[model samples]
Target: MKSAKSETLKGWALALPLLVVLLGFLLLPIVMITIVSFWQATEFSIIPAFSLENYEFLFGSSVTYKVFWATFRYALITWALTLLIGFTVAYYLAFHIRSSNVQTILFLVCTIPFLTSNIIRMISWIPFLGRNGIANQTLIGMGVINEPLEWLLYSDFSVILAFVHLYTLFMIVPIFNTMMRIDRSLIEAARDNGASGRQILTNVILPLSKPGIMIGTIFVLTLVMGDFITVRVMSGSQAANVGRLISNDISLLQYPSASATSVVLLVTVLLIIGTLMRFVNIRKEL
Candidate 1:
């Protein structure tokens, strides 16, 4: 009994720090948000009173639904593009490359974009994608079009383009890590059994890479869904999303409204992550 009690105490001691951090940071903030979400807010003052007005407003507004649809649309499109590009890159790195040194170097190359701040990298695209910018000038020089494409920047295309550029690394790294852990003998055996390259990839590699793909999907979806800056900057405020909605509410001194919107967004993101985790053993795969 004494030994077991001592071990239990030690375990608790180890876990205490994490428990403290989670309670102080994550749980406390959520509790505050939930509380504030029920409180009343005015233009000049936040009143300490309980009300469901914020939620009623949020749910009743057609604008809210449209913004959420835009959020989901961004998540889906970004997820698809990242998966396709990330999978291709990971496969080439894991299977095609013979030398581990070369693979490391190439992987490092992929991370070079990450060395700069995200804002700077995103802003850099403006010059490249703008009218009379590199892309437009190059296309014009090649006689692809007579005039500069206005939709190249400050549009949905730019938003998605920036998303793919920024988050592709997130998708690539996880998939590559998972792919690296796959057994070489399985691939060799599949080859020896007269399995085609596609057969080997589909049967052997893809099934094993699910954890990574799911993880990457989670990362990209969360980032894109919670992002207001990207949409605002890239779309020139023409596009609306849940994040921007919350931000607008906050800017207008509507604390209750922002909190309510934030709570809804939190629930939505949690549901998505929960659903994905239900099918995959992310901890085991990692």
Candidate 2:
């Protein structure tokens, strides 16, 4: 009992720093935000009186619903694209590539683009997607269309494209790591049992890759949901998401409204993560 107690004390000693940090940085901010969310905001200043007006206005506005729906649209589309592309790349890297050295090199290649900041990568797309940009010029040169596609840039397409470009690696890395942990013998056994490639992929590989998929989903969703800069720049203000809504409120000095929106977003994300966590055994991955 003494040894157990001593070990427990030692573990608590090691973990205390992280616990303190979480309480100070994470929990404290959330508590403050929740409290401030009920405050009143005026033209120039915030009033600390308890008020539900912020939330009432937020829920009453049609724009709020539209913005949230748009945010979900962005997340859903990005998640689907990232999942399909990430899974394919991870599958190839995990199974098809025989050499471990080659896999490492290729995996490093996947991360090369991320070395630069997301803003740079997002801005880089503007050159390629602009009216007279390479995509339009190339298409025109190939007689695909005579006119430049004006909707290419500063639109949802550009926003989602930039999203996929920036975040696909997040999806790939986790899925690849998870796939690498899969036992090769199980795959061979499935093959020996006369399972086709499609069957094996659908049944053997995909079923085992759930933890990684869930992890990657969480990462992608969290990033996409909280992102304001990417949507603002890439969409050229043509789009409005919940993040941009919060940003706009903050810019207008509507602190209470911003806090309320933030609380809603936080709750929304937590609910999603909780739902996904139900199906995934994260311990297995750990």
Candidate 3:
């Protein structure tokens, strides 16, 4: 009885710090945001009165629909690309690489992009795609193009490319961690039983990695949906996203509208993550 009490105390002590932080930072803010989403400010003040006008404006406006659709479209495309590339890279690292050292080296290389600031990485694309950029210079020098391409920057393509570069690592790490935990003998047994490489991957590997894939998808989709800076910097004023719309509203002291937009985004992301979680045991499956 004494030992059980001591262990319970120890567990409580360990969890206390996390519980405090979660309550103070995450839960508290979320609760406040929920309250504010149904509020309207008077005379441009910090204090807001409770109302449904914000939500009414959000759901009733066609502009909100357009912005949300744009955000969703880009986010989905980015998520799909990240899943494909990240899984392929992680799969190779886990199964094909025989040496632990090589695997470590490759993993480090995968993380190199994350070492640099996202802004710097996105800015780097500007020079590469500029009229005097290396790409244009080489193309012109080789007579591949008569003139520099205007479509290189300030376009949806540029926004998607920047998003993929920034978020692919999020997908890779989870998938790789999950893949590493998979029993190697299972793959060997499948092969021994006359399963081809494609058969093994499609049947054994993918099914087992569903949890990781779902998690990575959720992360990428949510992050991309909320991002505004990358789209602004890379695509200039040509591309508009939900994040940009929120930023614009906030800039004009439209807190009620901004909070309403945030609520919608939050609910949408949660819905997606929740729906995915239902299909797999994210923790144990991984």
Candidate 4:
């Protein structure tokens, strides 16, 4: 009984710092945002009074609906691309690479680009994708096109491409971790049983990789949903997203409206994550 009590105390002591940080940084900010979301916004200042006007305005505005649709579209595109590429890369690294030294070297090479500033990395693509840039020039030189590709820059395609470039690493890391943990014997056994590569991957690898995929999905979705800078910079201010909308509101000093929008976004992301969790109990798999 005494030892159990001591263990409980030790656990609580270890958790106390994390609990405090979460309460102060996460829960507190959420509560404050929720409270602010109920307040009234005016031309000059936000009034500290309970009102549904913010939500009402948000829902009644067609622009809000369009922005949300665009945001979801971007999120979906980024998620799909990242998952596909990440899974392929991770699979090759985990299963195909025979030498651990070579695998480590390749993995490090993948992470080298991330060592630089993300903003710089994002901006670097502009010159490559811009009109008269490397891509357009190359295509033009090859007589592949008469003119530079306008859709290559400052468009949905560019935005999604940038998102995939930036966030694919998130997917790869988690999935690689999961894949590395998989039993090699199971794969060998499947092969011995005359199971093809496709069959082993479908029936064995994918099932075991669910936890990592869930984690990667959560990361990519949340980051894409909350991102304003990437949308602003990559889309050249032509496209609107939930984050960009919230940013505009904040810039205009419409704190209440921004808070309301943030609340809505938070709820939407939570719903997505909750739905994903229903399909895969990540805790059990982990």
* 165-224 per-residue lDDT for model 3 (tens digits): 899999999899889988989999999999999999999999988888888898899889
Worst 10 residues of 4 by lDDT: 40-49
Candidate 3 lands at a TM-score of 0.94
Per-residue CA lDDT of candidate 1, range 129-170, in tens?
999899999999999999999999999999999999999999
In TM-score terms, candidate 2 sits at: 0.98
- The lDDT values for all models are 0.95, 0.95, 0.89, 0.95
Task: State, as a TM-score between 0 and 1, how close model 1 is to the true structure.
Answer: 0.97
Per-prediction TM-score to the true structure, in the order listed: 0.97, 0.98, 0.94, 0.98
C-alpha root-mean-square deviation, candidate 1: 1.0
Report the C-alpha lDDT of model 4 over 73-179, residue by residue, as the tens digit.
99999999999999999999999999999999999988998999999999999999999799999999999999899999999888988999999999999999999
Looking at candidate 3, the ten consecutive residues that score lowest on lDDT are 41-50
Candidate 3 ranges beyond 4 A from true positions: 1-6
Best by lDDT: 1
Candidate 1 clashes between residue pairs 3 or more apart in a chain or in different chains: none
On a 0 to 1 TM-score scale, where does candidate 4 land against the true structure? Answer: 0.98
Model 1 residue 34 CA deviation in Å: 1.1
Error of 4 at 79 (Å): 0.8
